[model samples]
Target chain A: MNRKLLLAPAAGLLLCCFGCQDTVNTVENEPQEPVSNIRDVRVVTDKFLRDRLIIRSVRMATAASGNQVAEVAATNARTGVFSQAWSGITGENPYTVAYKFVWMDEAGMAVETNLSAWRTVQIKPGETVFFKSVAPNARCRDFLLNLKESD
Target chain B: MKFRLLLLPAAALAALLSSCATDSHYVDATDTTVAVKNKNRMSSSDWVVITQDAGNALLASPLFEEYLEAYRIDAEAALKEAEAAGEKITTREKLTAMKPLLMLSTIQNNTSEHIDSKLLTERLREILFNSGKVRFTTYAAGEGQSIDAATAQARQLKNDPNIKKRTALKKGTVHAYDLSLAGVIIKQTAQDGRNNEMSYTFNLTLTDNSTGEGVWTYSKEIKRQHKQGALSW
Candidate 1:
């Protein structure tokens, strides 16, 4: 009887862990020509966070006003729920993240502007979210994106 | 002795609670640490998001690019007309005069909470001005009058030796606003059992003052829900 009781709880726990994992499925048309202006960069800090928030690619294009525009595609790589045992409350994978963009001039110096602000975006497991920003003026030729977990 | 022992424990508990009290800390206004607390009222974080979103939308719109182009065209035409009329208007003057002036009309706050919509308007004005595409005229009539009177006074004193070195002030040179911006913020609330949800909708419109027609319009909605006792303030 003791063995059966132990097995029952063990099986229930296993089921909970496996069944709670969430993932997304996607379908797209045939691959088109790759964009030439897309840059490849390194991500070096916070391996756990870097894994959860995966940066897929960064692309740049010219806007109508002759200013540079950038788009970042990031995916949520988390797979399961992060639950609090005491409160019996569950949170979905890929928690809310806040992001901001800084514009840079031709000399790679940051362009100072007050219009930029941190914006919040939520992503689901395995889902990709695109963040787009435009340079503050024609002087800006490059950009940087900063991301952090929302408190 | 038993009563005294019980009191001792109670006093110790109170001391512990006092020691555990939270201390004040500073957080950046743009940081995510600021979150919505009251469902019925707008928070500073909400203001940041709304202003950012509005600025982004306005900047990305084709209308904004067209507006800048139209200013250049208007300046060139004005210079040509002045030259034809035998008035001496320099290219530098025309270049400096191409900034399109915009006026803040009204922001209707239809919510129960007392919100200073001027904050949003000011943020918008800052963004538009920083973009180098537009300028803002004072919303106060009294302020406008004062500025006009000051400009006239400065023009009268232009020939004074003390003021001769200063830039010449001119009357009737103030660009009248070609565009006006107005908006309304509406709050709606709904309750379902222990869950209360609040939605705030901000609707903004940019209109051509001469034509009295809207050139660009945008609406942003922010929704927050609170389950009673789920969060501690």
Candidate 2:
């Protein structure tokens, strides 16, 4: 039997390549928490959002999360979910929002901008958000994107 | 060459363990626009005390010298009992004919912050309007008169069917000489149903003008959960 059907598709492609390398080393060795309630913090202006301008938010429940259920403990921000494609917006939005992120080093240059650092966000009143630039300085691998117009 | 000196001490111990490795990310800090540390909340002032100036409101507080030394020792013991009864009274007319005072204070949210109960009631109405001896009002500072345009401009200056008319409707005290300062802000939370070992109370009782009946009572109890890590305990 064709050598046991090519060794049963070579043992199902070697167990799908070691089960995708054991799920990327168990998600880079789990455990990660520290980022505060950046609400509906939007800004995705998709359309392939050149220079990457599609960052969305969801995760803001603390007063020590007790009995959880802030819409079921929505800590959203494990990044990785993008289907892209959308267009819609109009009225009652005079404009007033702020965000700016940039930091890169690791021979990639660009850093030095932390005037006693900060980053808090929230936005909801007809949502349609997006955000960009994450790599919040872990010796920053690279990132940059800013948006202004809030007073 | 012993394998290029063992590959230069394994590339200098892999560049000294990748320059003391450390690269993991995720930081929100309750992102209320991230200035971190309990988003926003750090007021100096954002007041409001107009309930028809609650009897010359002011005495907002730094214990306005403890209510001006308890209203100058209750107007020097009611002017030595009106000068031993000879009665020629007038320590500012016996502190404006006493019987209108109610003092109290305790608005502690001692910043580890979750403030903005209107910035601790606008710094307790600027310390009870610089404590001129309690006569404050600040239910969000509103009451510049308008219960139907002040009884329709006091009924057009007591009526005027062309300057002169009778009692087609003229009564009195439709809400006059009113005042209010109300109380409470004490906070210590274990989350709603409360009790994570106790310390959570948020009870605000605002008042201004006609909601009257509030001679003064302030309270505080913000012990934002025995902090830790940023350190405190």
Candidate 3:
């Protein structure tokens, strides 16, 4: 009787523990994805920042009048990483980076322009790299820089 | 004695079944686990900024500093007027006063083109409301209080002739607030350039607090031409 009693309860307990389960949606190689990204970035501010981006020329034209652009200088590529860290965020876990550029005129009006390449980059841990982007369109005179945290 | 021995096992089995324990079985949705998440990626593509040597060279000029300083002041002032009412003040308040209300995530449209209006709008809305400046409202009263054709005859003696007057909030009627902001990403570039260089323009605007006019506007332009021997990103 004693043996039977112990076996029955023990068996039940094992079944309960073994049956408990939960699910989570996850994948591997997500590291290749950036930790953070910025969109709608408008201008480039710092001179030190100018060195980090790879710029390329695109086939685009402009309107007869200089105020508006009829075509754009499409960005052929962008950086996988750009910039420093802040807010106790560093390295691979909460990686921080950003990029930006500005638009200006020959007379420097800072006119409203349809601009910016929506690009994102992912940097591996312990890797130092620069960022790049092409002008969003023709008639872009100035650029701004944006550095943001990466996931 | 034999029966008693068997009773022990039976009692143990019963005890195990009745124990405060749980097991999985094919059951209704209520029995399933539910997950809650912020939906923002912890790691995403980093935002990059690129500049040209000429863009950098101009920064040494005094004008860039002056321009940036002015915009910094404007940004601080407007932000203060809206949020300064609630904060602990100290020395260097202007530089360190504003508090972060919304934890922003870079809204991305991983799809090829820039079709991120939905994400952008939602993020902006989150920023506005998260600041404690606005709250959500369903305004269910519109459906319940409006008089349909069935009740149209009951309003014949209404004193107010203006349609807007009827819906006008009474003096003491509690009303919720409405908040919104307009932000556009404007872009422009050079008319002539063929040296494998990149140039861009950014035109940002801040509107008036009261009249909704473009109170303050600023532009920063940067260009980078990669010289054969020069450093470029």
Best by DockQ: 1
Candidate 1's residue-wise lDDT over B63-117, tens digit each? 7677678767886788788889999776656666677678877888899888877
**TM-score, model 3 to reference:** 0.21
Say which prediction, candidate 1 or candidate 3, comes out ahead on TM-score: 1
Q: Please provide TM-scores, in order, for all candidate models, with all chains considered together.
A: 0.79, 0.22, 0.21
Worst 10 residues of 1 chain A by lDDT: A81-90
What's model 2's lDDT at B231? 35
Q: What is the TM-score (0 to 1) of candidate 1?
A: 0.79
lDDT of model 1 at position A61: 80
Candidate 2 runs further than 4 Å off: A1-80, A83-120, A123-151, B1-119, B123-177, B186-202, B208-233
Q: CA shift at A29, candidate 1, in angstroms?
A: 2.5
> Count of backbone clashes for each model?
0, 38, 68
C-alpha lDDT (0 to 100) for residue B214 of candidate 1: 78
Q: What is the interface RMSD of each candidate, in Å?
A: 1.9, 20.2, 18.0
Which pairs, if any, clash in model 1? Answer: none
For model 2, state the Cα shift of residue B78 in Å.
Answer: 28
CA lDDT, every model vs. true structure: 0.74, 0.36, 0.34
**Lowest summed lDDT window (length 10), candidate 2 chain A:** A63-72
lDDT of 1 by residue, A30-55 (tens): 55766325765665666766877888
